[model samples]
Structure formats: structure tokens, C-alpha cells
Target: MGLLKGIDPILTADLLWVLRAMGHGDRLAIVDCNFPAAQVAKSTVTGKDPIILTVPLPQAVSAICELLPLDYFEESSVFYMAPQDGVAMPPEGNAVIDELKSAIATVSSPDVSIAPVERFQFYEEAKKCFAIVQTLERRPYGNAILVKGVIGPDGKDLKPN
Candidate 1:
């Protein structure tokens, strides 16, 4: 299989699936260590990330984004979650941001906006994302949400018809 820079190989298959079905406005959540994924996955029983799970949130997001197209020009093409305190986010959060930049280097992802919300708001949104990829990172607020965008008719990443 092909690969993207900074992406870890463990979740490559799942990342590929993210690429195929998710469309603009569709979201992907990269959860931090304590997200209660085990409880979240109770319905499907997709076992939680094992204690031995490797890969950091940034690396996981990078891998998942690879499956996604970089053009997020639609109004809701891409969205991110940060703390509502509105304090300057920490550098760790930028990990995903950097990857997004790299992914969009050759495309347009204006819809790709990172919005800060209350921690609770993030949980609510995370529940509805196209899907969430739980990472092994133990850092707090390392979570992120990304909306999908489409390639424009003119060959740019814009909202789909």
C-alpha cells in the first residue's frame, strides 16, 4: 500500500477506508488516551486501543488524513476542535495542523478550519463524526476533529455538488 509522510503503518488500512466513504463536512476524530473509547465502542465492540498501542495522535491524524483528499473548500469541509477557554492552544495541537498543511500543499482546503469549543462540545461532536481513530497519546486535549472536502470541478478541493 502507498503511504504519507509522518503516518504510522499500524492503522493504514483503517485510514484508507476513511478516504473512500467520508465526504466534505463529514468529520474524523482523533481521540486522546482517556476518551473512553471502550465505552463508546460498546455497541460495536470494536475493542479499545490496547495498552500496548503505539503511535501518537499527530502521527495517527497524519495517517488518516492521507486517506482523505486535501481540498476542503466547502463551508463545512473541514473542522477542528479546541478548548473553549480560547487560550492559545498548545503546540501539540499544531501537529495535526502541520499535517493538514502538508496534505493541502498542492490543493485548496479553505473549508479546513480549526474551531475551538468547550470540552463537552467536542465530546458531542466526536460522537457524530464519520468515525474516530483513537490514538495512544496520553496528553490532554490532544484530540482533534477534521471535516471532509471534495475536489472541485475545476480540479481544486471544493465542496462536492
Candidate 2:
């Protein structure tokens, strides 16, 4: 069966609320299986309830990107988890990047670049984001973070298409 028109079921009500509530420059983090989600989203910390979407990383990340305009002002709006402890980006990370690129293409977004953040730094960043999506992807380094951009008065993207 199909979802309601223009409504993606992959984006749950909680996720949608978080997206809608976020203003421009707000960041959203989509984390892999290995990341610490609950620990970071503590009410004692950011005072915002944690949002977890139990889908695969690529789907969650792409769907989110499709709905939310990315921050074009930044040098890199999307960030992936960099290799840590002398390891490099795993095969899965590459696949996730390909998936994200395809999503950016599907949306006709002008900026398709994704930056890398060290493991601990990524976690710290995620802790401060508007929300975090905990995907079921078992692949190492499948995490990604996205910064939100603004929509213009003419109903066009503020960031170039």
C-alpha cells in the first residue's frame, strides 16, 4: 500500500515534528548501529526528547534529506563519521555516501558534498543536534549529520538548486 500523498511514512510523526520544529542552521544527525544515541539525547542534556527511526541508514538519511533543504552557506552541510583508531572508512560508509549522493541528485540539490568528522567529534555534534535518527544499519561508519537550510518567500530553496 502507498503512504498518504506527500507524506513519507519513513518519517514518523516524531521525526516530522522534529524536522518542522527545527529552524534554519539546525542540524540533524542520522546515526549507525554502533553510535550512542540514548546516552547523548538525555533530557538532562539538551532537554529535547531523542528521536530514533529504526530503518536502514540510507533510507532514513535520504528521505530526511529529500524533505529538508540542506544548509548551503556551510562549506559542508552533510557530515559522515570518519575512521577512528587507525582505521579507514569501511566499505559500508562508501555505500552510504553513494546513497546520500543519489538522494541529493534526486532532490536536484546543488551541493552534493559530504564532510567527515572524527568519531568522538561526531558524537559530540550529534548530542547538540535537533534530533538523532538511530538506524538499524549494521555497517560500521554509516552515520551522517545534516544541517537544515531555509526556504525563500517564493517557495523556492534559498540555497541554489
Candidate 3:
């Protein structure tokens, strides 16, 4: 029932296995409840059902960051779903986005780029990810994708040559 001391309870054994199985440069999509996760997941590398987490966006991101390193090889390691109308996010959505950003920042390298992708583009990209994780976050556009990075023998993020 219990995992390692610092591990978040939200991270189940199956989720941990997925994370461990992922290689550097693989992608992990963390999507909101409204996201068509089941449909998109079918097209992902894993070609399996999404790992569902009954937690808020920020909480899920924080827990995942504890074990998954963000890819430094890419120009941007994190991508969030952008508004379809190109308008600013609503106050509630912005708040949720802000919290998720903060949570990712706390665990990721300072140089990690967090960018936004168009809604449709995000969906396309999510379909290419290694796996999808559906969270109970209800805020609009609360979807993000993380590029996995490697930890070198020195126990630090592997930098590109």
C-alpha cells in the first residue's frame, strides 16, 4: 500500500513502471478531465489506456516531477495547451495554470522552457507521447506535456553535447 517515504501516494506502482520504462526524449502527457485521453491514448507509443489520477493539475504535476526529469535536449521541455480563440485564459484557468507552472518550476531546472501550444496541435502532440495521464483537473486548457530527460551517472540531468 505504501511506497517509498517521499513518493506521493497518487503515484501508483503502474504509473511508476511507466515512468521508469520511458527513455530520454520520450513524452508524457498530463491532461485535464475534459481531454479526450482515451481516444488520444490509443494513438500513443504505449497504445494503452491512460493512467488516471484523481487529483488537481498542480498536485499531479508535482508528484510526477518528483520522479520524472524534464528533457533539456529540447528547446522546450514543457508545453501547455493554449486557448483556441487566442484569448487570455480566464481567471480560474489562469490560477490553475499558474499553480501548475509553479509546481513544475520547483522541480525542473531553471532553464527549462515552458511554452504553449495551440489546442489542436497539443492534441496531435499528445497522441505521439509515450503515455497519457488524465487528472481530475477541471480548469479549462489544463493540459501539459513533458519531455523526459536522463539522469547521468553523476545523478544530474544529462546535458546535450
Q: Estimate each model's TM-score.
A: 0.63, 0.87, 0.93
Candidate numbers, best TM-score first, in rank order: 3, 2, 1
Cα displacement (Å) at residue 26, model 3:
0.4
Candidate with maximal TM-score? 3
Evaluate model 2: give its lDDT.
0.77
- Which residue runs does candidate 3 get wrong by more than 4 Å? none
Q: Cα RMSDs of all predictions?
A: 5.1, 2.7, 1.5
User: What TM-score does structure 2 among the candidates reach?
Assistant: 0.87
Give the better candidate number (2 or 3) by lDDT.
3
Looking at model 1, report the run of 10 residues with the lowest lDDT sum: 43-52
**Which candidate tops lDDT?**
3
RMSD of 3: 1.5
Clashing pairs in 3: none
Q: How many pairs of residues in model 2 come into backbone collision? A: 0
The residue-by-residue lDDT of candidate 3 on 49-139, one tens digit each, is: 9999999888999999889988888899999998877587788778887887899888876677899898889999999999999999999
In model 3, the worst 10-residue window by lDDT is 84-93
Between candidates 2 and 3, the TM-score winner: 3
**In candidate 2, what are the lDDT values of residues 1-161, reduced to their tens digit?**
34567777888887787888889988888887777777766622245556677788888877887678787877888888887778877787788777766766677474556788988888888877877778887787888888888878977557664
